[model samples]
Target: MTPEEAVTTRASRRSPRPRADAARNRDRIVAAARDVFVEHGTEAPLDEIAKRAGIGNATLYRHFADRRSLLRAVVLLIMCRVADHAERAAAETVDSLTALRRFVHDAVDERVGAVCGLLIDGGGQDSAEVAVQCRRVEATCETLMDRARHAGQIRADIGLRDLVISMSQLARPLPGIEYRDADAHRHLDLLLDGLRVPAPAACGAPGGAEERSVTYTEHAA
Candidate 1:
């Protein structure tokens, strides 16, 4: 064989075709980890994650060197996805308040908040990439919230911390009960009602049924 042809053949041998099965396995692992983390928090057993993915411990180790690594990957994945959704929500609608409401509703519906809730309780070491991803998500949320506030849709007393804490708290599952996105959404709708300005009462409306907007006092930071 010619020298150039021989070199090309060697390179091809070194770089075999992509392993479709391996790729599928990695995907399954990521998905399973996400679910396990949401259900059991980040401290969930790695072996359980493997079993859920239909893979062995050795395979799980091959893909993720340690639990911290796996947790970071899950955090990064969920953050990026939620950020993408936030970006799309921010741009898709002309009404800033509508966009914010839509984003929050959809986020709760998808249980994105629950993922973050687990991470907060996990207390795992966060890699720089994971931290950066987290900042990105926070910034996106800030933008959405600010826009809504500027549009007079959100109360002046609300802040990013309030939103995050509410999300995490609402996302958490009660003892002996599993987390349900529907339950979260229901509470979120009630919370949103509190955030919005109340409609003005009609002239000569019945007493005691008048809408009252919650008075929010901003505390010193």
Candidate 2:
């Protein structure tokens, strides 16, 4: 090829530099949206999210087509984060029970339940990306629960659905209570206790006497 033609070809084929600034803007928007949703549910205004991200409404809409689209993005981000946490907990903890318990604590601590409302109906986004991420999160939960059950750390009847529902309900904020209430953690502890297997009685005998057991009969907000 001629020199001029070769130069033209290289120029045409050269990939543009990575849009680092746009990527940073997208990250900021997602982070701001998550914070807003945690504080005010998914109905929080897009303008507020843009303001929080220090971006304009036009830019926000450019990144996300609409409110539902933005909600889907935030939910996807959260599911990915939770899935990573579950993997880390499973790999790092020595016992399956500890890993399972830590996942619940850390996930709730991350306010995953805050986004559960958005996921109530799949966030109204039918994209393949969302579906795949959801499956990964579900698989992690199943593995954790299976490990715990096999180790006799949790009741055999407990399943992923039960764990998720309980965590979602627990993560919800009470009407008149502050988000950082100590009682909330205590109540969560009670819920976790219910999922555990009962310990063997200190005394053993034929037709043995009743064993003292701690039954969590109620969960108070």
Top candidate, metric lDDT:
2
lDDT by residue (tens digit), candidate 2, 79-116: 77888888887786467776776677777766778666
On TM-score, the candidate that comes out on top is: 2
List runs of model 1 lying over 4 Å from the truth: 1-18, 114-125, 199-221
The 10-residue segment with the lowest total lDDT in model 1 = 212-221
* Superposition error at 213 for model 1 (Å): 17
Residues 51-102, candidate 1, lDDT per residue (tens digit)?
A: 9999999999998888767776776677667777788877875677656656
TM-score of 1: 0.75
- Per-residue lDDT for 221 in model 2? 13
Alpha carbon lDDT of residue 208, candidate 1? 19
